[model samples]
Each structure stands twice: as structure tokens, then as C-alpha cells.
Target chain A: MLKITNLHANIEDKEILKGINLEINPGEVHAIMGPNGSGKSTLSSVIAGKEEYEMTEGEIIFEGGDLTELDPEERSHKGIFLSFQYPVEIPGVSVTNFMKASLNAHRKANGQEDMPANEMLKMIREKSELLEMDRKFLSRSLNQGFSGGEKKRNEIFQMAMLNPKLAILDETDSGLDIDALKIVANGVNKLKSKDNAVLVITHYQRLLDYIVPDFVHVMLDGKIVKSGTKELAYELEERGYDWIKQEQL
Target chain B: MELKDKLISSFLAFEEAFDVDSDIHEVRSNAIKEFESLGFPSKKEEDWKYTSLNTVLKHDYSVFPKKEDALEYRDIKKYLIHDIDTYKLVFIDGIYSSHLSETTHDKIDVCLMSSALSKSKYKPIIDAYFNKIVPKNGLNSLNTAFSKEGAFIHIHKNKLADKPIQIVNFSTGNESALMVQPRNLIVVDENSQAQIIERHQSLTDHPVFTNSVTEIFAGKRAIVDYYKIQNDRASASLIDNTFVEQQEESVCSMHTFSFGGKLTRNNLNFYQRGERCDSTMKGITIIEDKQHVDHNTLVHHIFPNCESHQDYKGIFDENSTGVFNGKVLVEKEAQKINAFQSNNNILLDDKATINSKPQLEIFADDVKCSHGCTIGQLDEESLFYLRARGIPLKEARALLMYAFANNVLESVRIPELKKRITSQIALKLGVSLGFDL
Candidate 1:
């Protein structure tokens, strides 16, 4: 469903993703494990079309189409969602209003009519219930003063609402506790289907314990050096990344 | 002739209609003398440092239009909050439009300033509060001298107005260039409450200059909410000077929404005479093109245990310029006072300019005073976050700006006015909010 071949990317002339090749098929959950500054987030940012990162040489094909020239909103309308590590705090815009605007924008891009208010509310209620969110939480300003777990859960809530084709969870497990992690993982697992895919980028395997991945990749120094199954995540957790770096050397 | 010289001659011609030996005439004489000494403020003055009147002053604006132009209510109904019940004091070319006005005198006095100045019953109030709180300034004196027709609102003790008051002044471009001065006086006695909305609109692209002064007195335990809607044409300019005084346990709030105009200068001041009074000054300015808007506010806490809050947000795009000067003062005897001031701005383009200054003078040893000023661009990361969620760039930027100005709009007590301002904000941002406020 998604393909990245030799994705060489840089931020301000400093190469972050040197050379990387990865692919994920439909219904496959791929977990990318790496240490800090290993280009895992860079790969996701480049896929989502962040403007700061320049693609010196690479090709990212999504659903048999090149995504290099599309703007971020265009990429979003094409069903690619990035659950940020740190969601921005947009004060005075409630979660419900933000989602409505977003969903209507998507519809407008697709030449579809605006979703009815009843259907919109119904969808919000269902998705928020899946993430175990309070009704009051949906009325608060988007991510403003939200706890880490709440923000992460809110991200998954948005994921559930949009139901993107390729979802990238960038460090979704960092600030989550055991309970929130289970809720988030369970939500992702429930949303998984044969026509969609998820790319999970995380440092630890605790989240992987709940949402098992079909393939696990170890990224070291801007390159994916090892590819294995879910067992590789456990092995990395048991033995630190240093052993992997040593092996790569 | 210069515009200043023309105004002096217009003042002489305007005074001929009234009795020259009356008490009101004496006040007008004193005000004109003050204006003659101080013709107009220049950039050299500290208070007018960032905003210059050179361009707006260059027009040979007629002090008074010779012909009284009439307008159909349907054409200008959108300018007023007509959806709600209000006592409207409407004007066309500085002349009172009685056909378009809804004045009342049964329980409260919601009528014209001309009648209030000439009538016998309102003379006591005119003598008491007229020009009482206004500090000596060229613009205020100029407006005071030419003050003939505006809104006059007075609420008695222990009485509540049946509805809100709306003062809307419209210029019809009858004169090649027109200049109007509107004076409003509001006195809410003890245990009374009132809501007022003021607006200045030019129907056409006539170079209209409006110099307006409003004096508001809030009595003990009175609640006063006032809003100013300034969205004039590109050829219009406005100088609004509002002075308010609060008694014991009074609550007074001012919300100024300046969206469009060639130039607008608002001087708003609040003085607390008794303890436990609260003053709120909130403003939102969104302007593009060559529009300029300035907000100058002061909150003086004289008695102990009073509080004041000032929050001003400005968004300047294109070559628009904005200025905010917020001042707060707490007297030595006013202990346990809390004064907070915040000015935040976003310059969309590189050429857009904003000059923000917060001046706090606290003489009380036990007062808490804090002020903060911020000038920055919209966060790119935040913008990306919104755009990534499928919201277009234009709508996303508008949403962010609306969010930035939303907190100030939250304090708007009038529901209709709040919704109107929200819609205006959306319109100014050139996007649809897609939902009700």
C-alpha cells in the first residue's frame, strides 16, 4: 500500500534520512524501532510532506502514485494520518469544531456535500467512545492543557474519526501509561482492516506488546539495518540498542 | 485652507445656531479654546508616537455637511443589531434620523444628545457628567466643541433598561469630504445595569473623518457593558475618546472590535472611585491592506480592593499597521489591587507592523500588577498540524486567528453581539467558520 525506496532526506542541508527502503502492505502493521535521531520521525515527516524537510533524492509512492509534490493538506485528503509525538495546542478551538472543519475540508476537496450535523455528532460520539474519552473532553480547546495521555488519546480519537489508509503513530507510546497505552492500542487494533495500513514508530516495545506488528525494523544512523518479526522488538528491549549498533558496526 | 483652519471657522458657524449666552455655550467656548491651542496631535507626542495623522489630516474635510442626506432603513439595517430589541440612536451625515431611531423616555432615557443638551430636564445631568471625566486633549476638545447629535442613555437608581442601546452613525458621502463629531453621555445610577453598542459606518468611499467622545458613569453596584464596532470604509477615519468612571462595587467592561478602516484611534480610560470595583478592557483588531488601528487604554485604581484586566489582540496583514498602548495605575492607598495587562499581536506579512507598549505605575505596596507583550508570527508547526488534518491553508490560518481572538470575545455579555463579532471575525479572515458561535 505504501512504498519508500532509498528515501534520502535532509533538513537544511544536514542529511537525516540517508538511505532507507521500506514497504508495507494492506492490513500490515509495521513497527520501526530506533534510538534518538535515527531518522524514524524524519521518515514519517517526509511521508506526511513537512515543508522543512527537503528530499535530496528519493521516491515515496503511495497507492501507486508519487507524493513528492502534493501539499500537506492534499496528502491528508489522500488518507495519510500522522499522530504527532507532541500535538499542538490550539486554544479556543474545541476538538469537535476542529474535527468538523477538518472533515468538511476533506469533503470539499472530494467534491462531496458537508456531512449532516446528526451524522457528524454520531461519528464523534462513536469514535470518542472507542478511545474512552469524556464528553466534556470533546468540548475543551484542542490539546490546550491536555495531559500527555489525554493528548495521545485525542490523537487516536482523531485517527478513529478519519480512518486514514496509512496511519503513522510517531512515539504514541512515549507519554502513555499502561492503561492509556492499552486503550490506544486497542483502538488501533479495532480500526485495523484489510484495506488499510499502520506504520508505528517507537523507541520501546511496550506498545508493540499490545498491538503486535507483522514486521519489525531496526533503524540505526539513518538506515534500517535489521528487519525481523515481533520477536525483534522484544529482543531489542531485552538487549539495548547499543548491541544493535555494535552489530551494525 | 488647511483642515484645522476650516474646523475653527466651522466651529464659529456652528455656534451661531445655539444661544451664545447659555451655560452649554460656555462649555463649548472653553472646549473650542482648548482645541485652538492644541490643533492636532503629531508623531512628536509620546502618546501619538506610532500613529501619525498626516495622511488623514490632509483632506479638506467639511466640518458639517450642508445637506441632510436620508437613507432607507433596509439598506443600513445590517449595520445595527436589528435582530434584537434595542433603542437605536441613528444618524445620517451627523444629523439625527428620527425615522430610523427608536428613542424612549418612559423608564430610562435613551434618546438623542441634542435633546439632552437643549432640554430642561436633562440639563442637570448634562451639568453633572458632561465633560466631567474627559482629560484635556485636542481630539476630545475638538469633539466636545462640535458635539451636537449623538446618543444619550441614562438609567435611574434601582432600574434596569428594558433593552440594550445601539448608537450607529452613518455618513452618506453627500459632501465631497465630511468630518463629524458625535458626543455620547451614559449615566447608570446605583443598582442599575445597561448594555450599549456603538458603531461608525460610511456608506460610500467618501473621505469621512469622525471624532467622537463618550462619557460613561457607573454607579454603585451598577453593571455596564459597552461595545464599539469599527468597520468603516477604506476612505474613512475615526478618533474615539471614551472616559468611564466607576463607583463602589460597580462593574464596567469595554470591548472594541476594529476590523477595517483607513485609520482608527481609540482612547479608552476607566477610573475606579470606590473599593471593590472591577474594570475590564478587551479589544480585537484585524486589519489588512493599508488600514491602521490604534488602541490606547488606561485603568486607574484609586480605592483599595479593585481589579482591572486588559487584553488586546491584533492581527495585521499586508501593509496594515497596529498600535496598542495600555496603561494601569494603582494609587498608594489602593491596597490589595490586582491589575493585569496583556497585548498579543501577529503580523501575517513582513511589512505589517505592530507597536505595543504596556505601562504600569503602581504606588501601592500591597498591589499585584503584571503586564506582558508579545509580537510574533503564526507558528508554522501549528499551521502544519491544522493543514495535515485536511483543513486548507486559508481556513486553517483563519481558525488559528479566530482561536487567538476567541478568549476576548468570550467576555461579551450580549449574545447577539458576540455572534455578530464572531461572524465579523470570520468575514475579516475571509473564511467561513461553518458553525454557529
Candidate 2:
């Protein structure tokens, strides 16, 4: 579903991701675990086409097109989603209206008419129920005065509503408590299908326990040092990332 | 001739037309003398440092427009909040359009200022409140010198106005350049309530200058909401001076929305005369293409336990300019006063300019007074967040601006007016979604 060849990215003069290559097949979930400042978030941002991070020498092929040349909105229209680590607070835009605009924009980009108001409402009701979000939660200003767990859940709620082809969860589990983690994990699990993929980027093994990945890649510096199954997550969590740095050395 | 001299000379003709035996004649004569002394405020004055009336003062304006510049209601319906029923005091070319106006006298006086000044029945109310709170300023004096027209609303003691009063002034461009001075006196009696909306619109591209003065007296426990909508043609310029005096426990708020015009200046002042009085001044300014808007607001806390708030936001594009000068004064005896002032601006283009100054003078040590000012572009992260959700860059920028200007509209008591301001903001931002998001 996605391919990256030697993704070398930099922010300003400092290189963040030196040499990175990865591939994920359809219906697969891949987890990338790294310590702080190890370019884990940078890798996800590069994939999502954040403009500030300059992709110096690389090409990202997703759904038969070079993603590097496209803007973030174009990528969004092509079914690419990035659940932000910190969602922006828009004071006057209600969450339901935000979802409606996003859904309509996607439909318009695909040469389709706007979804009927009733159908949009029905989908919002069903998806919000799946995420255990109260109806009142959808009426508040988008992420304004929301708790940490509420923000993460709202991001996932957006992900569920957009239903993108490739979902990149960047540190989605960092701020969630045990209960919110389970709910978010459950939502992602229910949305997984044979035609879509997800890339889970995290700093701990706690989230992998809830949404088990098909493969685990341990990142050191900027490159992936080891690739294994779910047990690799437990090993790294128990022994810490020092072993990974030693292995790289 | 310069506009200043023309106005001074026209005062004689205006005085000759009115009755010299009337009690207001002395007031008018004194005002004209003051105007002659002060002339038009020069840019060198501290209060007029940022706003220059050079462009407006250079026009050769006709003091009196041609009589009965007829206008059909259908042609100018969109300029009004016509969806709701209101007591409308509409004027065309400085002459009251009786055919289009709905003045009332059953419970409250929502009628023309000319009749209120000439009629003997309303003489007492006029003598008590007329021009009492207004200061001796150049433009204010000029308005008072020619203050023969405008809206006069007087809500009796303990009486509620039947509906909102809308005062609309339209210039038909009958002359090359026409100037109008509208004087409004609103006295909400003790325990009474009222809402007022005033707008100045020009039908043609001919230059129009309006020097308006409004004096509002909120008696004990009265509540008054005043809104000013200045969405005129690019050839129009407006100088609005509104003075509000509040008694004990009264609430008075003024909201100014400046969407269009060449140069618009709002001098809104609030004087809290008694304890527990509240004053609020808020505005939103969005302009482009050499248009300018200036807001100079002052709130004086004279008594103990009073509060005042001032919030002004501006979004400037192209070569448009904006200025916000908010001043709050808490006197020594006014302990426990709470005063706040905030001015935020966004320069959409490189040439856009905004000068924001927040001045606070507090003699009461126990008072809580704060002021904040910020000038910047839209939040990049917020823009990218919307863009990443498949919204186009243009739409994203518009949405951010809409959100930026929406908070100031929250205190709008009238839902229909709120919607109107919301749609105006949307139109200014070039957003397709019409209603609130």
C-alpha cells in the first residue's frame, strides 16, 4: 500500500531522517518504536507531507503516485491521514461542522456531490457512538478547552470519519489514559480492513499491547535497526532503548 | 473652499433656517463657536495622532443635500436587518424618509430628532439628556452645530421598548460630495431597557462624509445595547462620536462592525457615574485596498465597584490601515473596579498596517485592570490543520479568519444581528459557507 525509498529528510540544516526505507502491504499494521529525538515523528511527518521538513533525497510512492510533489491537502484527498500529536484548537468551529466540511471537501475533490445532510448526520452518529463520544462533545468548539484524552479521541474521531487509505498515528497514545487508550485502540481496530493500512509510531510498548502490530521496527538515530514480530516490543520495553543503541554501535 | 470653512459658513445658513426663540438655539450657537475655535482636529493632536481627516477634509461637500431624494424600500432593503420587526428611523440625503420610517409614540419615543427638538412635549427630556455627556471635541462640536436630524429615542421609566430601534442614514449622491451630521439622543429611563442599531450607507460612489454624535444616558438599573454597522461604499467616510453615561447598576455595551468604507473613525466613550455600573465596547474591522478604520475608546470608572471591558479585532489586507487606541481610567475612589482592554490584529498582506495602543490609568490600588495587544498573521498550525483535512488553502485561510473574528460576536444580544455580522465576516473572508461554523 505504501513504499519509501531512502527517505532523507531535514528541518533546516540538521538532518532528522538520514536513510530510511519501509514498505507496508494492504491490511497490515506496522509499529515503529524509538526514543525521544530519534526521528520517529519526523518520519511520520515526512510521510504526511509537512512542508517545513525538507525531503532532500527520497521518493514516497503511495497508491501509484509520487507523494512528495503533492501538498498536504492533495495527499488528504488521496486518502492519507495523519493524527496529529497535538490537535489545533479552533475556537468557533464546532466539531460536527468541522467534520462536515472535511467530508464535503473530500467528496468534492473526488468529483462527487456533497453527501446528503441526513446521511452525514447518520454517519456522524454511528461513528461517534463507535468512539463512545457523547453527542454534546460534537457541538463544542474543535479541541478548545478539551482534555488530553478528549483531544486524542477527537483526532481518532476525525480519522474514523475521513476513513483514509493510510492512517499514520503519530504519538496518539502518549497522552491517553488506560481507558482512553482502549477506546482509541478499539476504534482503530474496527476500522481496519483488507483495503487499508495503518502505521503506528510510538515511544512505548503499551499501545502495541492494545492494537497488536503485524511487524515491529526498532529505530535508532534515524534508520530502522531491527525488524521483528510483537515480542520485539516487549523485549525493548523491558530492557529499555539502551540495548538498541548498543546494537547500532 | 476647505471642508472646515465650508461647514463653519454653512452653520449660519442652518441657524437662519431654525427658530431662534427655541431653547436649543443657544446650545447650537455655542457649539458652532466651539467648532470655529477647534476647527477640524489636526493630526498633531495626541488623540488624532494615528487618524488623519485629510482625505475627507479635502472634499468640497454640499452641506445640504437636495430635498426628498426619493428611494424605494425594495431598492435598499438589503441594507437593513429587515427580517426582524424594528422601529426604523430612516433618512435619505439628511432628510427623514417618513414613507419608509416607522416611528412610535405609544410607550416609548422612537422618532426623529427634529421633531423631538421642535415639539414642546419632548422639550423636558431633550433639556435633561441632550448633549449632556458629549465632550467639547472638534468633530463632536461640528455635529452638534448642525444637529437638526437623526434618531431620538426615549424609553420612559420602568418601560421596555416594544422592539429594537434601527436608525439608517442613506446618501443618494445627489450632490458632487455631500456631508451629513446626524445627532442621536437616547435616554433609557431608570429600570427601562432598549436596543439600538445605527448604520450609514451610500447608494452611489460620490464622496460622502458623516460626522455623527450620539449621547446615551442609561439611568439606574437600565440596560442598553447599541450597535454601529459601517458598511458603506469606498467613497464614504464616517466619524462617529458616541458618549454613553451609565448610572448605578446599569449595563451599556457598544459593538462597532467596520466592513467597508474609505476612512471610518469611531470615538466611543463610556462614563460610569455610579457603583456597579458595567460598560463594554467591542468591534471588528476588516478592510482592504486602502480602506482605513480607527477605533478610539475610553471607559471612565468614577464610582466604586464598576467594571469596563474593551475588545477590538482587525484584519487588514492590501494597503488597508487600522488603528485601535483603548484607554481606561479608574479614579481613586473607584475601588474594586475591574477594567480590561484587548486589541488583536492580523495583517493579511505585507502592506497592511495596524497601530494598537492600550492605555490604562488606575488610581485605585485594589482595582483589577489588564490590557493585551497582539499583531500577527494567522496561526500556521491552525491553517495547516484545516488544510490537512482537505480544505483548500484559500478556504482554510478564510475559516481561520472567521474563527478569529467570531469571538467578538458572542456578546451580540440579537440573534438576527449576530447572523448578519457573521455573514458579513464570511463575505469579507471570501468564504462560501454563509452561516456560523
Instruction: Go through the candidates in order and give each one's DockQ.
Output: 0.77, 0.64
lDDT of each: 0.92, 0.91
Off by over 4 Å in 2: B434-436
Please give, for residues A107-162, the per-residue lDDT of candidate 1 as tens digits: 88899988899999999999999999999999999999999999999999999998
Question: Where is the poorest 10-residue window by lDDT in model 1 chain B?
Answer: B428-437
The alpha-carbon deviation from the true structure for residue B230 of candidate 2, after best TM-score superposition, in angstroms, is: 1.6
Looking at candidate 1, what is the lDDT of residue B186? 96
lDDT of 1 by residue, B228-266 (tens): 999989999999999999999999999999999999999
Clashing pairs in 2: none
Predicted candidate 2 versus true structure: per-residue lDDT over B87-119, tens digit per residue: 999999899999999999888889989999999
TM-score of each: 0.98, 0.99
Question: What TM-score does chain A of each model score against the native chain A?
Answer: 0.99, 0.98
Best by lDDT: 1
